[model samples]
Target: MNETHRSSTDSSEASHTEDGLSGSFEANEDVEKALLPHMDIKSGPQNIGKETSWLKLCSRWPFLVTFLNISLFIASFTLWLWPAPLRHPFKTQDYWKETSFYSPILERFDIPKISRVTNGTLYDTNPPSVLRQRIGKEADKEWHRIGDHVWPLVIGEADVKQLGKDPRVAVKIPEDLGYGSDAYIAQTEVFHHLHCLDMLRREVSYEHCHQQDISQCLIMTMVTQSTPPTPQTDLKTVVEARTREWHFHIYFLLQSPTETAAALALRDAVLRLRRDGAFVAVPLFRVNEFPIGPHPAGSYEIWVPDSSFSDVFFYLAANRGNLSVLVHPLTSSQRRDHETRNAWMGTPWPIYLDSLPSDGDVPLQYPELGLGWSTSPEQEISLEERLRRGAKVEALLANDPEAAPAPED
Candidate 1:
């Protein structure tokens, strides 16, 4: 009897549970039907089932939906329209006391000591045999006398006659003096200067003959003995506007073989101008394989007289190939001569301006070189003839100096 009672109780509970679910589903359908009139006709009946719950929520609380939409738009717009914040300047904050910071790795490192070695003796004290053989006994004995090299002996007949007629004099030399005919005179200071250089060269042994030592000796001798000219104490001071001389510096790269060869060729061409007794006024120039004075590159100087300035300038401008040329004046003010009164061919180069003097007399003069250069336009060699002779000299210079025939004076 008790078992039958338990089975009957179970069947009754199942029937009640099914009835409750049906009632709940019918209530939801009734709610959806009531909300359908509020929904838009454009939604159509087919979408009613899908949008039923959403439509009921919006109808009950319209302001909540509007507020949520506005909040979402503001968040999105803020993110889109807001400008990017700028980076702040970094400030070192005292995280700990400055004394607390320590770099153990850096403390262990030690700076390496640099050792410098300098060469003291550049040249030998003993004279070379080749240089000894070239020196004359009298010159060797008088090597201490700087004047011996300052003035060389002029024994040539033509040089003496030419010295008398030199244009440097205020008055003409008397024709009756018979300088060339009766007595042979010594050469001018120019030749003497060359002689002195040769004497200095002989002091070093051939094996010990360093170009730097020779150069340094000459520089030291000149610098120690030389003094600037005293300016005249006059009431009226006169400064000449025109330049008396000019320096044409032909530049080349010492490291480049081709450029060096071109430089040598150009030098040879200029030297050729002196051949065949032409362009005698063009003085002997110096070729510097390294930087000297204000020049910053390997260069050679061509000293141009005021009279032959145009001809020489034209020639250099035409001939300087892939090479830079610095044309500057020689004047009382070295700075002004190089800075203001200068021109360039090809590209310009930087020079050591501080090496030049601010105020001084012309550094070099023809009077010091030799007697004087004749400036008579008629006597001056024509540019065409110089060019022709230069070509021939270049050809001759290309061959061995010993093998080549001597160039005519």
Candidate 2:
């Protein structure tokens, strides 16, 4: 009985030992699985959570990790030695921004440039034929333009007020000279220079670095403001009554039904005279304040500085296409001394004026005056002669309606 009991005890002890060994082996297997890199097992409570599949390592030891990485790098280099085909550098906004300095970069392109004359200076680009024709229609003979580019430039004379500060016509502005109070001469000089700008530059296109369309506006405005009275039967008779023969004087010819309007009309007409390259400038002229006799209501006497009279007369005769002109002989001073009483001339004499026309339209002149010049001087053609020439030309053309045609290939 004792022997059987001892055998049972030994069997039970062996079974307990076997069970303990089996449990320890299973626990070791589970631990090994957890430590392997990138294995499908959760690494709870780590900075890189179980979702971090992008980071895969074969070893748990720090040194082992270093060794593994070195091997991996070598393998990568070997793969690169026989590299795959290239791929696009970027696939998203974040990637694209990293590669490029933001698309749509700004850069300036060089282009040819040009300018248009206005107020005696060029401020805009010349237009291709397209723009030039359009602007010309509006300005008549008043503007000239040039181009560095395809743009059209606005051209007009600069005004006195704009001279000093404007990019154009500043040289003519007056500065204080020691001549002191009698600087009226200086004022006169300034006016003369500016008035000379009253004409367009002799048909050329110029250049300006930049542009402003002020001159065109100013010229148009000034024309409305300047005026003198008009209307008389004969411009020659009016001047003859004012001064003796061989004297210097200017004659204005017009027969205005309305005196006030005639004055305004004359003013506008004169301003636009330079629209045609003729009559470059109107010379210094003064209206007669005192008269020799009872002049008609619309008559005016314009005095020329004695010295300038020849210049005035010549300019008129050269440019006169119409009007009956008579010269009275009177010797006068071109310049006056600056004394009030002792001076023989109050001013370089003066042009006389008695009235203005009634109708206030300009560019609208009396057709009786032969040439359409708002200003003067056109080849000595008298009014009657001018009319006669027009009639003759019409008759000749009417007689031969079929004109000659040159041969063309």
Candidate 3:
């Protein structure tokens, strides 16, 4: 209250501050504004808590805040690192994106097809979506066109390379609500490609790991070229402008499920295909690599049969008891006379007989329609002539050089 006391107090505060020991200095309004940190924070109508100090949790427990941030980072990293499947009652956009990884050969077409000899009744609809999920990027909308109630089909690219294996890539799912594998197959047709690309007919079994897996669909691609070549060949030789020694064959397989329910789903799909006049289509492969045999049983050969189709069917049944096709009449037979035209027509896999029977057991000697094979022409050699040349060369090679006539005695 007195002048001496006020002077003493002010002097003492100054001395304490100067000595770096003042904890009770009078903080002025402008003094707070002069702070180096948070100086830019202006006091205005926009600044609701002007002059009020902010107490952050980090200031209380810095380590705990740091641990929480690290946990968030780890969680984010885990989501990015491990691509896992999600379960939703209904499919999501992400589900569509993830399912788009697998694709199909052909998506949409108008022609009716039969999958196997004994699938079931015939109907006109689409195949399931699972098949479209197999081909990956190859089955996108830009590369394919699907018809209503039909399945999506791709306009296959002629990749001289990248044969013999399925390349996994991003595939776009159709935005349409009904877009799926059944619709893809029903609607799609390989523009220039036969059901089969002659890549080789191998039984690439599928295990539907999912609940709706279609393991029973009778899937087959019947490729035929009359002295024509199949695609998917290496350019063995380019004589000139003509593609020579081309390759061709059909592809077929029976995919099933790991669980019995999945198996039934597959069987039902086959029955649907048989009933729908649409042959179930799945991943295709090559015949040479097929485990069944190097040569289709004469009875099994759709091209040249050794016995009645019933015998062939029964024989196939006996050997492949696990392999089941719908044993019923379907619209495919009604719309298309199956056995009359193609021996393997009704079945998912139709066997091909080499054109050059004279050559015996050599599929190479036959003139095949090229599927996805690369080719250049040395000169155009007729298929028959090519066979003759190949046969002569084979005969000469088969001869025993050591058995040549010895010098006459």
Q: Which candidate number maximizes lDDT? A: 1
Off by over 4 Å in 1: 1-240, 277-285, 368-409
| Candidate 2 per-residue lDDT over residues 224-255, each given as its tens digit | 33322222334333332232212222223334
Give the TM-scores of the predictions, in the order they appear: 0.32, 0.15, 0.19
True-vs-predicted CA distance for residue 182, candidate 2, Å: 42
The weakest ten consecutive residues by lDDT in model 1 span 94-103
For TM-score, candidate 2 versus 3, the one ahead is 3
Candidate 1 clashing pairs?
Answer: 149-192, 153-187, 154-186, 154-187, 190-369
Better candidate by lDDT, 2 or 3: 2
Candidate 1 residue lDDT tens string, 306-339: 7667777887788889999998887777866787
Q: What is candidate 3's lDDT per residue for 1-409, written digit by digit as tens?
A: 2344445545654565566654444643333444322453333323434323334543558878788999999999776544233212323443332222222321221223446553332231266332223344433331233212233443222221222211122143454745653221212234334233312112333554432222222222222232222332222322221221211122333222333343334334434543564431221122223323223321111221111224334533443333333222112122121222223323454432211121122232222422111222543356668658866766676667764542232
Supply the TM-score for candidate 3. 0.19
Per TM-score, the best of the predicted structures is 1
Candidate 2, residue 85: lDDT:
23
In candidate 2, position 5 carries an lDDT of: 42
